[model samples]
Each structure stands twice: as C-alpha cells, then as structure tokens.
Target: MKNEIIIFSGIEPGKKGAGNLVYFFLDRLKINYVEFKLHFNKTPDGFLIRQLKNFVPRNLSKSLYYSFYRFFFKSSENIINRKVILFHPQSIGLELSINLIRNNFVYIYVFDNFLFCRKSYNYIDRNKSCLLCLKDKDAYLKYKCDFFPVKHNPHKYDDFLLTISNNLSRVHFLTQNRNQSNLLYQKFGPIPNLTQIGMMVDMEDVVFNGKKTVKKYDFLYHNTLIEAKGIFYFLSIAKLLRNYSFIVPFSLKEVRNLIPDFEDFENVDFLSIKWNTGLKEILINCQVVINPSLWSAPVEGALLKSIKFNGCVAVVTTEYSFQSEIPSNVVIKLPDNLVEASKILNDVIDSEKIRINYKNEAKKWFDLYSKDIDISFDKFIQEEFN
Candidate 1:
C-alpha cells in the first residue's frame, strides 16, 4: 500500500516565497500532492461586492455561494483515505473546504500568525478593524458586519495546529497579548501528538563569492514602500548618508502613491524593478541588505539570497529571534535605531577579510542544507508525520 499525503494551500503556484517553498519541497519529496488554485473575481465591481459582503447579512451571501461551490466541487470520497494538511485558514472559502473534509484525514492548521492579526503589513486581513472577530459577535459586526464565515466559527474545525517555530508561536501569543500555548493547553488540554515544524530554506541557490568589491553605502533597505515595511525609516537613513545610494525596486508610480513625494529623497536613486524578476539581481549588485520589519518572520529567503550573492544583510532588532542559518560574515543584526545600523553597515563594507570569512561560512551552511532533498523528505515523513 502506498502512503499518500494531500496538502492544500490557498496560494497560487509560481508565486515567490511561501508558495514557491511549498511547490519546491513537495516536488523534492516526490510526495503525491495536488495544488488547488483559489480564484477570486477580479473586477472593480468585485471590490464593491467584497465591501458589501463585509457589512451585510452574512447568511444571505454565504448560503448562495456555499451551496453553489459545494455542488460544483464536492470533496472526493477517496480523499478520506489520504493524509491531509491545510496550510492556512484565513480564507473563508478555503475554510469551507476544510469543513467539508475535516473528518477524512489528519487535519493540520499551519499558522503564520499574521493570518489572525488585524494589523499585519501584508493585506491579508479580511476584517480590517475588528480585533475580536473570533470571540465576540459584536466585534465581528464592527468589522466584518455579516460575512458568512463570520457567522460560522471556522477556528473550531481545525484539528491540529502547526507553526514555523517557537518565535512564530510567540507572535501569535503576543498578537492577542495572551499566552496562546497555554490557551491551547486549556482548551485541548495537551496535544503532545501535534507536530511543530520549522520553516526550511532551500540552500541550493546560495553560492559564496569571496570578498567582492561592495558598493559603498552607509545603510541599505529593500522592500515595498508600504507603511508597514517602514520605508520612511529607510528614507530618513538615506538622508543621513548623503553619499549612500538607496536602491528601491518600485516604479515611480507605485512609490508616489505609497509614499508622499517619494522621489524627493536627495541621495536615493530609484531602481525600477518588480520584485518577481528583480529581487535577486538587485541584491547581487548591492552592498548591504536591510530588513527593518517591526514585526515579521525571519525573512530567510532574502537574507540567504543576499549572502549567497555576495551581499551582507542587516535585520532590525526585535524580540523575534531567528537562528543564524547564514554565514556570520554576511549577516549583521542592526540596532533598532537607524544610526547604529548605518555604522554597522559602514564597518562591514570596509572590511574585506570579514566579507571573505562570511563567504566561506555561507558555502558550508548551504551545502549542509542542500543535502539530498529526497532523503530529507523521507526523514521528515517518517519522523514528523508518521
């Protein structure tokens, strides 16, 4: 008998980061898995409909679509025999699918935490204003009004919860300012059987180029100009380092809308490139990469990619800790303040030996992680899921 595992994530294929990670790992493992694409109506009127759905009678819209979707894409009876993992439950429609198949397999809820936090930098929040959608009906109305999923408790349907690390669990607990682990212990009362996994990076693409001449800059920042990414903080740093060049991967148009008079940065030169095509290229050509997210995951891909491409990375100070999966020479933890961060950037860029040492360290780290993916997957299955 062949063991089968079917994983479901709401993300579309070919996208970068999490979706790409999922696709790569599943393929590397040779796991029997099928990716389902979730589609939403893309139109100006769709936005209006989404707004109306948020504030109107929940049952009216939910019953209509729920029935239609179920009738069209009913769960296969054979699915009961396959082990299943549900990636994220933030999407209401996807939650419905989970409900339909809850009893058939091992139900795993992969928690990214930002899924529940209303103040996420990513535009993943369906209810923008409600902090209590999961607890109070009145709070749900204040934000979601009458969304169908809001009428039904989707969180209750999840059987097992998974997180990327202890830090991720801490964020989830901090989001509510409540000890979620203890809360889970109170409700479920002990689930030693539940599996907690760490997010894995594919180190195959990382190659160390020793002591390459780095572009001189006091500080470096990369990310969209959205407020949550704290692009303004970068802009301020750019002003301080009049000689430093700030490379931003946004079109003049997007920058204008996302930041007020963004072109006004005296020393900053905009490098117009979409993240999809230009992120790696930009990192390869820069000196230091700064990730100053007030609250975010370790941002492993960008950090590892920068080191691999012969650039140093400086992440902001935060309680959220990540294991240094990169070479020490290439990765620097920036102080919470931009001034201190700038000094660190200056010190590292001027030292060639530091760069060379980091490059060698990075090569070793990449080789270890790039060990046969099939063997890793087999071990993961036997130890983690079995």
Candidate 2:
C-alpha cells in the first residue's frame, strides 16, 4: 500500500530552493499528497474589516468583526486517513493548525535553525546594520526569523523533529551556521533520533558534459544584489581587477546608483538576466563563480552548482564553515574581507593545477550525492511512519 504524506511549508509553492526541493522529493516518491499554499491572514475579510474598524465605534465594531472573522476563518475538521503530516519551520500558528487536524497519523517538524535567528535577514536591508523585529516579544526576534519554540512544547504539540545535519541534531539544530553546532550542544540538551540530510537538489534535467572552458566572462556573481549578499563588496573587487571581465547578474539599477565614486570600469559589465534563463546560461559559460555572502552559510545546492560548472568559489569562511569535504579545486574559507578574497581568486586563476583538480573533484562529489533520491525518501517513510 502507498503511504500518503502531506508536507507543508511556510513559503509559496514554487519560489525557489527549499520549496523547490520539497516539491521535487514528493513528486519523485509518487506520494499521494496535496500541496496547500498557506494563507497568512487570520480572516478572509481582514482588510475590509480593518478599514471599517478604523471609522466605526471601537467596542461594538471590533467585537462584531472578530466574531465574524473567527466563524468564517476557523479551519475545518476533515482529517486524511493513514497519513503523515510534516511541517517545515516551526510556528505557533502552524502547530495550532496541526492540533485541529490531529488523528493517529504521525506529525514531524523539520528544523532549519537559521530560520530562527536574526542574522537570517542580513541580506534584506543593507543600510540597516542590525535586524530588529519590534513585533515579537523575544530579544532574538528582531531578524524576522520565524521559528518559535512555544510550538514544540510537548503538552501542547508533541511532534518528532528532523534536523538537517548530524552536528545540528546534537545541538538541536538551532542555527544554519555549522560552526555553531558545538555552541548549540552546550545550550540545549542532546537531541534524540536526529538525522543529517543535506539540502536536496533536482538533478533530473541537469545536463553535465565533463568540463569545458567557455569564457563568456572572467567572473560572475549570481543571487540577489543586497547588502548581506556582499554585492557592494563584489563591485569593489571588480574595480580592483580592472583587466578582468566581471558579470553582475540581475542586480537592480538602483543598487548601482547607491555606490559613491563607482565608475563604469570598461571591463566590468552589468547584465540584467532573469534567474530562470540568463542566470543559468551565465553559470554555464563563466570561468569562475564568486559568492560573497556576509550572512548565512553557503547553500549546498549553490556550492554544488558552482563545482559542477568547474568554477572556483570565493565565499566567507564564517558563514559557510566548509564542513563537508570539498573538492580542492573548489576553494572555500576565503577571508571575510573583499580585498583578500579578490587576491585569492586572482591567484587561483593563475594556477592551472587548481582549476583542473576542482573540476575532477566536483564531478566525483556530484556522482556520490546524486544517487537515487527516491531510495532515501522511501527509507524515511518506512523508518519514520511505519
């Protein structure tokens, strides 16, 4: 008999990355499930009710609006039989929803600690030095990180926790920074039945043709052009490497305008490529890929993609601990300072051996990781639910 699983995430169905992975895994397993796009508003007529509440008398209108909202917005009691429900990014509101649908089916929560920390929002606003969420009562709430421990209270919501890394499981996997695994272990007691599953990528359509030197540009930087992503820092490095060709993909024109004394260096070109088309083609052509994220570790998929294309990675050591063994060709643990990062990247370009080694290493690693994902999914279902 096929087991039915319902996986729910806070994000919309097809934005990118984790959400995309979730969809891919479910499809691969051929699991019978429904993907529901969660609505954040507490009421259907919330917008109209709030507008009317502002003009009408406070006491009577507020009571009437809330009563109407609750009657219409409250979740129904229909529960799926012999099914397992998995919730990503623990939230008090989500836990409450699960309780309303509770039956004999198992409920599991996937933990990604970075989602709970303030540093997660480092890329959001460059001008703002720190993340501060005035809405939440917790001191660490400022970053707009969504995880809430209150949702995990046993008496209220008893659900199994599946962490992303073994090191994280030891510390209850509170942050995305793998380096802080020990720190978390010190804070929280040891976790039980924890598993380490690296980030998943859909490779069915990914065409790999050994390594080819297609020098469309000397260097490329993909991802949002925001502060924490180190876009400004990358621009400065491009200025220093005056002779080398640099490509900045999908950066807003306004971001370039913000930099003072930023000249249009002849070799540097800013290309407005949509992520779906231009970005992929650029990755395929570039000789090197540079990622200088100030916050959050390197996503496994991003790092793996760079390696697959036989490109070197220049990223902050603090963010991505370089925990998993990497191809020596793929450079990790670069200086947090942009000048140092630029120097290292330049030196690697000069070293032919380094480039060759990385290409070979990346292919080997991808093969090892690319083993049938369906097998893992089947194992997870049997072990966890059965």
Candidate 3:
C-alpha cells in the first residue's frame, strides 16, 4: 500500500523552529507527502475576522474565526492508507479538528511541553513550571499567560488540549530526550507509547568556515527577546559587562517595541533578522551564544547550534539534563540565579583557555550526535510498524 504522510502546522515561513525542523526532515525523507500549511492571516475571511476581533466576544471570536478555517481548509481525504504527523495544529481550530486525527495511524510530535504550562513558555511562576492550569481553568487568564494557540480563547484551549491529550495517548510519539520525557510524564500522569527521537541538528556548513574571522559582536543571543526567554537576564548581564558588546537579533522597530529601555544601552544592539547572507555572517563571528532560559527547553536548537559552530554556549541549570544528551564539554552551565550566572559569564569573557577547550569538546560531541541524527527519521518511520 502506498503511504501518504502529511506534515500539518501553523507556521510563518522561517519563524517557528519546530515547523522548520519538521519541514526539513520530511523533505529529506523523500516520501510521498503533502505540506498543508495553515496560515491564519491569509485565510479567506481573515481580514474581516481581524476587523471584528476586538468587537466580538473572546470565545465567540475564536470559535467563528477557527470554525471558518476548519470549514474551508480541511484535512485531505485522499489517503486511505496513510499517516499524519502534526507539529502544532492549535492554530487551525484544534477544537474542530480533533476528529481529523482520531484514527490509529496518526503520530503526534510534542516539541514543546506547552501542555504543562499555563502558557507556552511552560512557566507560570516566573522561571518555574506552574501546574495551576491543570487544576484551575482560569489560571491562564489569572497569570495573563498569552499563548500562540487559542490566545483569545484560552478556556476553549484548555478543553481542546484535554481532548488532544486524550487523543495523543492513542498514537506513537516522538519524544526528544530523557529530560523532556520526564517533564512530560510529570505533567501528563502516564503515557502508553513513546519513542525517544533526538532532534535533527545539521551544522557542518555553519560550524566550519575558515573565511569568517571577524568577531563583530562579543556575544549573540539571536532569538525572540521575550521575558520568558530570559531577555531581561541577558540585558542584566550586558548592563554589568559594559566593556563587552552583545547582539540581540531584533529590528530597530522591534527593539522599540520589545525593549525600549535597552535601546539606549551602548553594550546591546538589536539587529533585524534579514533574509540575506548577513544573518549567517553575523552568527559565524560571535564569540559565544547563550540560551539563558530559566525554564526547561525540550529541544534546544540554539545551544546545539552554538556547539555546532565550535563556539561556546552559556546556559542555566534548567538545561543540565538536556545537555547530557550531547555529552559535550563545550556547554558552560550557568547558574539559575541571575547574579551568579552573570558572574560566571564575566569570568568567561576573553578567556582564551575557555574558548579553545569549548571548540575542542564541541568537535567530539558533534561527531557523536551527527551519526545518530542520520538515522532518526528511519527510526521514526519504523515505530509505525513495530
């Protein structure tokens, strides 16, 4: 029987990391597949929906908006013998689409433990996981925890998630690592089926380049500078280290919107993420990359990329267990305490010994992880039959 694999998601081109990883691997798999992108902004009535977003009641607005999408853009019924791989269908009226994935052939991949969180950051009580949403349905609203899926309709979001979680138990899953697995188990009492698949990280092209030698920025933390992402922590470190420079990849416009206070800081520069080669060049020259998130990261692409570049990675204790999957010495585990993490980072600045050792250990770690990455897809496919 010919199999049809559909990778469904809600993506904004290059924005979501999970979407990017899923698309890359599905293409590499070279199978009979369909890429059904769920773009909310471009939907037929999207403009009208936005025009009326504020006027309409929150839950009613979400229901009308997503119900329109569910009615218009539907799951293709062509594949009788096929499998579905869902990244994040939360945006596509998940409340209405639950039945679309009710079959026995579906496989769901949970990239983020957002299910555990009152918010997508997977934290409620600053820098820590809060399970209040599990008990109090109003906890999401109480904390003002805005999320990508069901942002306007969180009550419905809770209902859909409970249903999705129940459905998720019916299929085989692709778990990232031991650390994430434990976290998911903690959040979700117990699961019936799981296959631990390592993240698909390829960085040989960006890692090794003899031509790129100019280190324009002293440090780089190129991600959406949100509070949950420890943006304030990075800024706090920059405030102390006045001598060194730091780059946060955000547009001049974004800087004004996201961190207006930090715009004047001489040590920090927020550059717009460009579509051109400039982005890669800027990434190559950074002395170190840091992911100072206080919350647990299931699939840490940033830290992995830093290791791939043979550069240094500074992180907090939340990443300790995830770091073990790499077995690399390049990772400089920072303390969760804001003051202490900065102090350790201060010592790391301009330390030639630290840089050299990190690059060396990264090479050893890359050799091991790359080999496993090569076969992860085959393992994922095999899980279906076995």
Candidate 4:
C-alpha cells in the first residue's frame, strides 16, 4: 500500500490567516493525504463549568485544556506505519505528535518554541528576548516565564525535553529559517534530521496592485496587541515620534490595558477590524510597517507580509538568532534601546531615498526567500516519494 500521509495541525487549512506553508504545499503537491485537527471542544461545557475554569489558576486551566484536547482526540490505529506531518501543532498536539513518532514516520514543522519553552513564544518579562531555556532546562521557571501570572511547574521543561529526546531518532524537524535551525543545533547539540525550509508566502494573499497610491499613515503596527510582540516598544516609539501619524488594528482602550501608562495620542489611529482584505490594503498603504517583536521570531508573518506586499520599508527588532539570514538592506533593524530604535525609524521616515533603497533590497530578498521555499518543497516532495 502507498504510504499515505496524515497532516495534523491545530486547525483546518484555508481558514482565516491560515494560508501557511503547509496549506500552500498541500494545495500545490496534491499528495494523497488525510487531515486531522485537534477539536477544541467536541461538546460544549456547562456555563458554570466554564465559569469555574475561569476562576481556576491559569496553569491548572492550561492543564485542563490539554486534558480536554486529549480526551476528544481519537487517534486511529490505521496511522501505524504511515507518514505523519505535524505543522505548527499546539503544545498538547505536539505531545501527541511525539507519541506518534514510535509508530509512524513523523515530520514535525517547528513554528513556535513549544518543544523547548512551555510558554512557546520564547519571550520573557514583556521586553526581553530569551533562549536560555534551550540550553539550560531550568530557565523557564527560574526566570518565571509563564505566559500567565500563575506559577509554573519546575520540572515541566525537564520532562518535556526528556520526551523529545527519547523520540528524536524517529522524528524529523523542519524549521522555517536557517538561523532558527542553527539556533536549535547551537543550544540542543547537533540534530542530524533537522531541515531548514524558508517560510512560504502565498502570492494570491498578497495585495499588490500595479498602481502606487499616496500613503495614508506614516507607520503601521499590525501585530498582535501584546508586549512580547513589541507593542510596548511601538508605544515608546510612538511617544517619541508624536508628530508622525501611526495606525494600529486595536482600540485606545485595548492599548491602554496592555500599557496601563499609555497616553491618548492624537496621531495614532486604531482600526479594530479582522485581518482580511481590508487590513491588507491598510498594510500596503502605510508608509512603514513595524514588527518590533522582542523575541527570536523565525520569519514573522507580519514582517514577511509587509515586505512582500507593502510598498514601504519594513522595520524590525534586531534578533541575531532569527534575522541573521535576512538581508541587512531589505529591512531596517533597530537596536533594543527604544531611544536608539526611534532614531532609526525617524531617519527611515524622513529619507525617501533610503526608503526606496530598502524597498528595492526587500524585493531581492523576498525573491530569494521564494526561490528557497520552492527548492525546499521540491526536496521535501522527492523525499516523501522515496
């Protein structure tokens, strides 16, 4: 029998903001496969039960979610001896993916830091980027890096690493960037089965018309409204550059909740809308799109989309481990210091020649990335066929 591939992820492909590499490859390859997604909840919980969960400690509630996922997850024995490709699975789903390693040829696509860090974002204390957990297993709890305010288990990292190490022989890991793959090896030792596949961008989703229009906003911060994603840094920059017009996909109240000390800036326009075609238009129309994430983000979607579709220059935080492969001229990288970063952004905004140069380099960089993705896909397909 042909080795049918089982594609498993947290959700179904082709959903909103779900046009990821796996989705792209599946459509292009047309490989014989069946799909599986973790059901959030097969049956609705009682209102009181849901309320009780809210009252429960965040760590315990997180445990509950995993238990619920496992309870609803019905894995078929037919998957034995088959090929399974896990694409950006949730923590619980990742655990399940590890378990499948013994019985099947498992290919795990790493998008987040779930394997090393329990919090998975690889960020700490709101403003700092971290990767200490990769080498020192105690770093997660020692640094109090839980996503929620609740205390985390001390041995969570230890146990998670043990599980992954045990299943290493039967698994193949695919990282989105070469730098990400290198970081894994530098921290976790040499991993022979790891492959670096550049992130896939669907051209159909890109909103680039031939005509160039006037920029309505001076700066755009369309990332999630979270501190680790550098919303605070963006705020700081906004505070510094009060004269420059800024736009975000969040309300003033929502922004205030994250940065309680946030001021009501008249120059900042908040558009609370779903990230659809409308948001794409806004992104392309903006003079600059900032992705100041305080983490070793491996080719962020926001930054990639902005570079691929937007007419303006993309600005990002300098993450040596993540952005090492990205061309220096393609995107403007700012230092960790808010003041220094603000100065760089100011320079970019003021100089039309610099913006044009960055945009030109960005086109070359994106073309290289696209070619890498195509080559990676071809190699992956050849391996799968074999």
Candidate 5:
C-alpha cells in the first residue's frame, strides 16, 4: 500500500498568505491528502483551551488534543502507513507540544528562524540575521527566543528534541530551512539529514497580463509596519528622498500619528492592499517593491509577483533566504544604516538609466529563482515514494 500523507499546519487552508503556498503545492501534485489546522478554531482548539494546556499534566493536553483531532478528522482516503507533514507550527505562537509520532513517517517544513528568533523576525541589532544564540548564552533571554510553550512550560524543548532523535520503525524528515539549518550546525556541530532548498512560487499567479508597466512611484514598502519589517528604515529613506513618492497601505493621517515627522512629506501616499489582486496590481504598477525586512524571509509572495510584473526591483536586506543564490544584479540589498540607505534611494530616484536597467533585471530574477512550483512538489513526492 502507498504511504498516506497527512498535512498539519496552524495556518488555515483557505487563507491567502504565505502559509497557503503549502496548499498550492499540494494542489499542483494532484495527490490525495488530509489537512488538519492548529489555528482557526473557537472550541476545543481555541485560545482558552491552549492556555489551559499549561495547567494540565505534562503530555496530557497534547495527547488529548491529538486523539480528539485524529478521531474527528482522520483521512477518508484508505492508503496505509501514513506520512505526516508539519509546516510552520511555531509561526502563530502555537506548538503541538509533542513530536511523538508512534507509527508513521513525519516531515517538517521550516520557513523562519523559529528556534533562534523568538519573534520569528530572524534578525539581530545591525539589521542582520546574526546567529547570536549559537554564540551568546544569554541570547534566548535577550531575544525571548521562539514561540514554543503556547501558554508557558506546556511542552519542554528537550522532550521535543528527544522525540525527533528517537525511532522505532518510524522516520522523521525535514524541508530545507537554510537559516535555521545553519544555526542547527553551530548548535549540534553538524546534522547528517539536512537539505537546503530555495522557495518557489507559481509563475501563473504573478505573470504579466500584457498591460503597460509604467512605474508610478520611486519606492513602495508594505506589510506589517513594525520595527522587525524595517519599516522605520524605509521611512527614514523616504524622508531623505524628496523627489520620490513612497506608498504604503495605511492612511496618511494614521501614518502621521504613528510617525509625526512624515506628516510634512507630501510624497507619501497610503492605500491598504487587503486583497491579493490589489497587492498584485500595486506591485505590477510600482517601480520598486521592497520588504526591507530585518527578518531573513525564506520566500515572499510580493517579491515573486513584483518580479513577474517586469518593472519592479526587489530591494531587500542581505539575508540568506532573500539574497542567497539570487543574482546580485537581480535583487538589490538594503544598506545597514539609514544614512546609506537614504543615499542609495536618492541615487535611484535621480538616475533614470539606473532605474531602467534595474527594472529590466526583474524577469531574469523571476526565471532563475521562482519560475516553477513543480520542482518543489516533485521532491516531496519522491521523498514519500522512497
């Protein structure tokens, strides 16, 4: 009998964000599988219930939750010897509290610096994703380190690690998380079963629709306007570049309240991109799209779409996930300090030839890093088959 595949994620399947990419991969494979979400619930899996886990006897809450979930939602598909796949459980500040797989193959997907960066931002002080945890003993206390213990002391990391290392006719597998994998090496010396794979997005979703791609603005930064996202860096640069218009998703009035200095800059514009198509249109129309994230994002849908639009330069920090393997000419790296970043933006705004050249590099970047989704799923299918 073929090995059955069960996907476990806290991210809701029908959602439109990063987590949904896993769903898209499953759809492309035409493979039958079952999905169980850890979040998006109000009853047994709600916040109160999760908080209650801390008080319950160790291992009890985990077992109870799994038993209840399995009994209620086990796959109707009749394949034997199941392979359970987990993705970004730690992302939403939730943990399964157990990796205790009794009689099945387990596969885990890692996207962020979950173990090292408590906030999952994947960065340290210098706008860089420095692996401080491996070096600094006080790092966890410094960064608060990880989303485990959904409530507090609900599950121990030692127990989780032991479960993965232990086996009784069962196998534990993993997807490539370059950033985390690098840390794992420094922590445990070296792990034998590690593989690093670059993120891939569906090309059709981001492909141009034959409309003229005239860039309306000089710079664009959206998503969470938090310090971790490097929004403050973008804001500082925006202030320095007077001729260029900077756009975001929040109202201009609200932004002034958030950062009063930006009030005087008439070049700033605000329009919330709530829908996927709207975001795509914005990226398609913009001259440059930047995350400028302090976190080393393994994959970004916005970056993928902007490249598809053919005129957008993906400006980002010099982190492994974003800058690794991608050609230097295709994706430009963000400067470490505000002064340098502002100077670079000023140059981009002033030079027409430079903007035209960088814009032309978008297609090359897209084709190299994110042209196909099939290759990614193919590896999963092969792993299951083997």
Candidate 6:
C-alpha cells in the first residue's frame, strides 16, 4: 500500500509559530496527505449561532470544536492504517489527542511545554523559567497558570497530562530543544519514542532582496506581547540608551497596557505591522533585534528571522535554554542580570565597529544551522515508518 499521512493542528496556515511551522513543513513534504485545521470558527455559522458565539465560554467552545473534528475523522472512510502527524495538538483539545492515539500510530510535535504545563510557556507568575509542574502534580493549580479560560478544577487539567504520559508508548514525541526533552524525560521517567529534532526555520521565507535596506531603527523589539518574552527587559535597555531609535511592531493600546508608560519614551516607535509583509521590512532595516526571553524558550521564530539578516545583530539572553541551540559565534549574548545586560547593550550600541564585525561573521553559521534543520526533518520522515 502507498504511504498516506494525516496532519492535525489548531490554527490556520501562515499564522502563529505552530501554524507557520505546519505550513512550511507541508509545502516541503512530497507526499499524499490530508490536513485538519481545527479553529474556533470551524463551527456552523448562522444568525443564531453568531449571536450565541459571543456568549459561548472559551472552554465549552474548545470541547465542541474538538468533539466535532474527532467524530468527522473517526467516521471518514479509508482512514485505517495511515500514519497520523499531530502538530500543536494541545490546541485541538485533550479528548481528540486521546482519540487519535486509540485509532492510529501518532507522532506529536511539541513546540512548547504544553503537555506538562498549564500555561504552555513554562513561565510562572510572570517571574522566571520553572519546571516545578513536572515534580508536583498540583504546581500548575497552585500557581494558577491556566492559559485557557477553564474553571479552577485541578483534576480537569491533570487528566490531560496524565493521558499523554500513560500512552507514551503509542505516540511518538518530538521537541526542538534538548532541555525541553530532558524536562519531559524527568517527568515521564523515560519515553523510548521521544526524539529531539533540531530547530528549523524556512530560509525561503527569510530571503532578502539583493538591494540593501537602509538602516532606519537602531534597535527592534518584535517579540511576543507576553511579558515573559522580555518586554520589560527591552524597555530597560531602551531607557538606558535613550538616544538610539527603537521600533516595536505591535499595537499601541496593547503595548501601552503591558508597559503603562511605554509612550513616554520618545526613542521607541510602536508600529502595528503584519507578520509576513510589513515586519519583514522593519527586520531588514533594523540594526539590532532584541529577544531577551526570561523563560527557557525553545528557539523563538523572531530570533531565527533576525539572525538571517547580515546587517542585523540579534541580542538574546544567555541564561535561557534556547541559547544552547545556537552557536555563540553567530549572535551577541546578553546576561540575565537586568543592570548588567543594559550596560552591555549600551556599550555595544556606542561601538559601531563591534556591530559591523559581528554582523559580518554570522552568515556561515546561519547557513550551517539551516542545513541541519533540513537534515533533521529528512530523518524524522524516514523514522516515522520504523
């Protein structure tokens, strides 16, 4: 029989990290496959349904979404004995994940720590990186780290994680970061099927025009709105170097809410730009791209894109686990300490030669890492049958 594949994820293509990853991978995969993108709007649309959706709770909406997709997939003909690939299945809901495993051999690609974490980012109380949830079953409940709008029922969340752990043998697990894999192993003893697939970035998506972009901004903070990703730290660095121009491509109101007095800084410009188009322009023109993630972030998409630009210097935290993935020679590593990190950034900004030298040397490593990801994916596809 010819090999058939079924891919599942929550978001539509060309969107968030997981969505974009799914989109890019599918474009590259030369095979016969079917994709099920389970979104909130996948529900039936009508005058009554439209009015009801506004009042429907997020948790209830999730349950209905997953249940519908599960029934559709289960009832579909010619689905037997085909390989199932799940990308960010946590967003599809716990019931569907369990159901998929029961019927088919599944491969679960984990971009974040959603299986064991309530918030999925492993960032607790907006403070720092933590793995307490792995050891203490009640840690997520204690911290009130639920990302979804679910009720305060500890057992409800625990059941989701326990299901994954119990069925480890049935579903193959994959992660980009080594530390994430270690943490998973720590919690589940040892998952024989677990694989550490290296980091990946679509080189074609990051391709720049041969003509150089004129340098417009001295610094750029285009990371996620989440505080744990280091908006506060970026604010501190901007404050320290008030004269340097900073561009933040995010909504004015949202950025203001996160940083109450963000508007007070005259040097920083917050322009709400679309991810695929406008943001790419800003990335090419910017001199430095700041991605000081406070948590053990699996190599961020922003960081990966920033490093591609030879003129742009990517400044990231040395403390986080993602730092171990990239070679030190490519990007500039800033310390975790707030005061010390700010000083180093200030010094780097003052010296134009330092920026030019670092930018010039990053391309070789970028080419090598790009090749590694391609090789990793090739291996992952071949091992799926084994």
Model 6 agreement with the true structure over 1-386: per-residue lDDT tens digits = 34556666654555665556766666546542433322221333446544544567434555455455545543234444557777765555556656677667778887777666666677763336777877886776677676542222356456666676777777788777787777778878878798777666554665444444365888888688777777877877778788899877786766775567664588887777655546777777666778777777786777777777644455554333676566665677876666777677677777888887767767777777778877777677665643
Q: What is the RMSD, in Å, between candidate 6 and the native fold over all Cα? A: 4.9
lDDT of 1 by residue, 190-258 (tens): 344343333344445434333443454434466545454556666666776676677666655556655
Query: Which portions of model 1 show Cα errors greater than 4 Å?
Result: 1-3, 31-82, 92-94, 97-101, 107-111, 119-190, 194-197, 200-220, 224-226, 261-263, 275-278, 296-299, 323-330, 370-376, 383-386
What is the per-residue lDDT of model 4 for residues 219-293, given as tens digits with 9 covering 90 to 100?
A: 888677767778877877888999999887787766765567777788888766545636677777777888777
User: lDDT per model, in order?
Assistant: 0.46, 0.49, 0.61, 0.66, 0.55, 0.66
What lDDT tens digits, residue by residue, belong to model 3 across residues 173-280?
667778877766665667787777767643435343334435588777755556656677777778877889998777555555555665467888876663233555
User: Candidate 2 regions off by >4 Å?
Assistant: 1-3, 31-75, 78-115, 119-187, 206-215, 254-265, 319-329, 372-377
By TM-score, rank the candidates, best first.
4, 6, 3, 5, 2, 1
- The lDDT of model 3 is 0.61
If scored against the real structure, what TM-score would every candidate get? 0.63, 0.64, 0.79, 0.83, 0.73, 0.82
TM-score of 3: 0.79
lDDT at 99 for candidate 4? 62
Q: Spell out the clash pairs found in candidate 3.
A: none
Better of 3 and 4 by lDDT: 4
lDDT of 5 by residue, 102-134 (tens): 345555566565544445565656466655655
Reference-based lDDT, residue 147, model 2: 27
RMSD of each: 9.0, 9.5, 5.4, 4.8, 7.2, 4.9
lDDT of 2 by residue, 1-386 (tens): 34444443443333355455555545644562433333222321357766775575433454455344333443353444534344343332334344433442433333333333433333344312222322232545344443222223332222322222222322222122243343334333464433333445554444433434354887787555546566776777888888788888754454544464556777777766644545666776676777665553434455555656544555554433343334444454466566777787787667867766666666776676556334555565556545
Reference-based lDDT, residue 312, model 4? 58
Please provide the root mean square deviation of candidate 1 (C-alpha atoms, Å).
Answer: 9.0
Q: Which segments of candidate 3 are over 4 A away from where they belong?
A: 12-16, 31-71, 76-82, 125-138, 149-152, 201-215, 319-328
Instruction: Look at candidate 3 and tell me the lDDT of residue 9.
Output: 56
Candidate 6: C-alpha lDDT: 0.66
Which candidate model has the greater TM-score, 2 or 4?
4
The parts of candidate 5 lying over 4 Å away from their true place are 31-81, 91-97, 100-103, 124-126, 136-138, 143-158, 165-180, 202-215, 252-264, 275-277, 371-373
